[model samples]
Target chain A: MDSAGVLLDAQGLGRFVPGTQQWLLRDVSLAVRGGDRLAIVGPTGSGKTLLLRSLALLDPIDEGRVLWLSQTISARLVPAFRSQATYLHQRPALIEGTVEDNLRLPFTFRIHAHQDFDRRRVASMLEMVGRGADFLARSWHDLSGGEAQIVALVRALQLNPTVLLLDEPTASLDASTTQTIERLISHWHERTNGKRALIWVTHDRQQSTRVAQRVVQMNAGKLLEGT
Target chain B: MTVDGYIELKAWQVAIAASLVLLNAAISLGLQLGLGRSLVVASMRMVVQLLLIGYVLRWVFQSDSVLTVLALAVIMTIIAGVAAVRRTERRYPGVYWASSVSVLVSSWLVTSFGIAAVLQKADTWYEPQYAIPILGMILGNTLNGISLGLNRLEDELVVHRNLVEMSLTLGATSWEAARGPVRQAVRTGMIPMINSMMVTGIVSLPGMMTGQLLSGVSPLQAVKYQIVIMFLIASGTALGTVGVVLLSFRRLFNRNHQFQSGLLTAAGHK
Candidate 1:
């Protein structure tokens, strides 16, 4: 009953294509604690993204439920849960607008309507990734891949979620861009004073060693202790 | 000389029907469009359908029962809804109900306004002569608008699934996530109405206006009828497209506002 210590708890989660018997992920269990920077490394088709998606409650699970801060998340409470523990895909989904337009989007939701769109705050967050205030006004079409990822990260980070689920957020970017994302996420976690957490699904072994406080490996839908 | 509420086509002039068949035959033969069989079949079917519709309308006009008018309107709504649903690129379990409710509601609201509020020359608002034709035109336009919206709903979801999910992850409700695509569908659905209005009377005469003119109504009176009907159509289409798209998008999510993609038909078909 007292899972207050756990930020997120994924218990024996499973997923399968609905009309077929084959399971894409099964018997997967993981728990994220506050300030834990956990990295998940695995082969290309090893279900890392599937596992992260399930943990974020983005995908419907066939066999298990997710508990956010010891409270079981029912279907009715998913949006709230997702708001607190958000998932970022490998490729950021941007609309046809300026970066400021996208950043202001979250406040449009009724749940977040109490919050106002803080342009000054966004400008500072942009500064963390070496982008200026004018970066917020840049068109979505004009942003390079690195700039897009930074925008996506800022978009999620500005929400001030308690947990961040990163699905190879820098999978294809060069080293500098990867470093920017890593540093931005690290600073975000560090500032929480061990009150926030992150889980990154990555294929790069070296990046995992450098960024993750503790690393886990997955193979064929099963989670394994990192060798 | 009068024929079917008109004085232009004399009974002896019915021979023009034979001339149309020959002209179509010449078009099919000369262009090698292979349209001969289709043209013949379509013309014959048109003759039968129109003749039957004429008799039905005559009976409806003779009657004064509100129930009879409603029954006919309900039947037409069902047919129009089914046609709209069939126009979708992807087949889903809910498009039938979604489109039907949309077309019925929009058509009913607009038709009631036309018959009861605008075109109130009949003894009662339920008079079949006024009610039937007004409801028919509104229903026809509403059906097309909604069908186009339904098709766009399926297409946009498949194409923009990622962006939609991104919105969901940001704490947006289902309605918020789909607002973009639904608006796009509604606009796409309304394009035909907008295009027709843009060129009405300038480039071509509309069906109802032309019919009124040929029936010996003064040009000014016919133009007035066309104007009223055009506004009715615009209202019906705008309402129908919004209704159908909103209904279609609502089913795309669950009570939790989580996007359940299973509501969509399998991809690769669109």
Candidate 2:
């Protein structure tokens, strides 16, 4: 980690089952600097999801701590940290509403109230993936698997978090859809102009190498260097 | 013991009326309804509880102290809170306080307002006859509402935790993430009351009004009191159920706006 340029860091991070002396993740550490796309690959139950969620500060950590911009993120700052370091899950859970309603959800928060929902921005983002503004009016339940995930991506991008923790976001999608998602992400990344970073968790090695400049492996909760 | 126009039944007569449950228990044994033992035990408990309450109410009536009434009211609220929490079959930290607030705020407000302001029986405002039974009725109904609401809230929150985290990731607060479940819980909690309200006059007569009519009270007077009590129940339940749900949902998230799943003793169970 380049301490000065590091945007997010997890120092000797650990997680244990609620009861008993069992470690789900132990002594795992990671750092994502601005403009870095880090991809973590591992087998099922290898804790890639756990590590990504831990780094995102979504899961409760039993050991060590996370730092936003090298400053340790305490309980008080976790929400603020979460707002900046967002996590996107593989399965999208959209609320019961039109696509536009789902997109407008974040601004309803006190944290995001100052930022108005910009329809044109969202429409333009959709257009990048061959979707039009009419996509906004699509009902949540009626959305295809690819489209829902796309909307979810758009929703997360609208917040413009400094770091994104993508957990198998395209694992279930077709090749075309996966490429569209990747394009959308790199497009968003380019738009940020080296100010943002991303950590992708994928099982696909070639795709991981293609997406991330720095690829790592997580197995049974321990993070290891990729060959 | 004829204090007024109300006809009082003797202890033996009351015992005879209560003995009918023994026959029901026997029929349950014969028909194999699977609740024979439970029926007997529940009936015995009911008898014991009602008899104890009867004697306690006698004492309360004789004393006629507002402090005693208030103390009893507090006890009722505390029990209601505990009972509601228990019904969830899941433990939630600090939910008792939320439930107590809900019960006290709603039941107390409705009961006090009904007797003192609506009925204009300031002389017997806190009296045992006026207060205890009314309090009992409201507490029982609101207890059911709050418990149902709380259980639904917890269940919904747990089942939809992923969605909640999704919103949090999108820069939403804990409240904003859980907005849907909290509202659903409130609505789910008041469902029983709403259903009761819908069928009150047509399907079945309410217990309170029935008791009044059996005691030879005028139909008009009984209906007037019934209407007042029903309105009181509806409003109290709405306010109290909503209050408990909101507070309960608040506790599910901490100061940092993270969903505290540890608060749940069990999840995803009906």
TM-score of each: 0.89, 0.86
lDDT of 1 by residue, A1-227 (tens): 34667989988899887878788888988888998989999999889998988887776789977888888877667777888999998999998899889888888888798888888888887788888888888999999998888988898888899999999999989999999999999888898699999998999999998888899999988899994
| Candidate 2 local lDDT, residue B217 | 91
Clashing pairs in 2: none
Off by over 4 Å in 1: A74-77, A116-124, B3-5, B8-15, B24-28, B58-68, B121-126, B266-270
Clashing pairs in 1: none
**Per-candidate interface DockQ score:** 0.62, 0.58
Per-residue lDDT of B53-146 in model 1, one digit per residue for the tens? 8888888888878888888899999999999988776776677898889989999999888877787754587888788999899989999999
Candidate 2 C-alpha lDDT tens digits along B1-270: 453667677888888988788788788888889897788788889889988987887887888899888788788888987787778866676878899898888898888888888889877787778888888889998999999999888888788888988987776767778888888899998999989999997999899999888777999999988998998888888888998998887788876677887778763342
Once model 2 is optimally superposed onto the true structure by TM-score, how far is the C-alpha of residue B220 displaced, in angstroms?
A: 3.9
Give the interface-residue alpha carbon RMSD of model 2: 1.8
Q: Tens digits of per-residue lDDT for model 2 on A76-189?
A: 667678889989999988989999999998888787878999989998999999998788999999999999999999998988888989999999999999999999999888
DockQ of 2: 0.58
Clashes of each: 0, 0
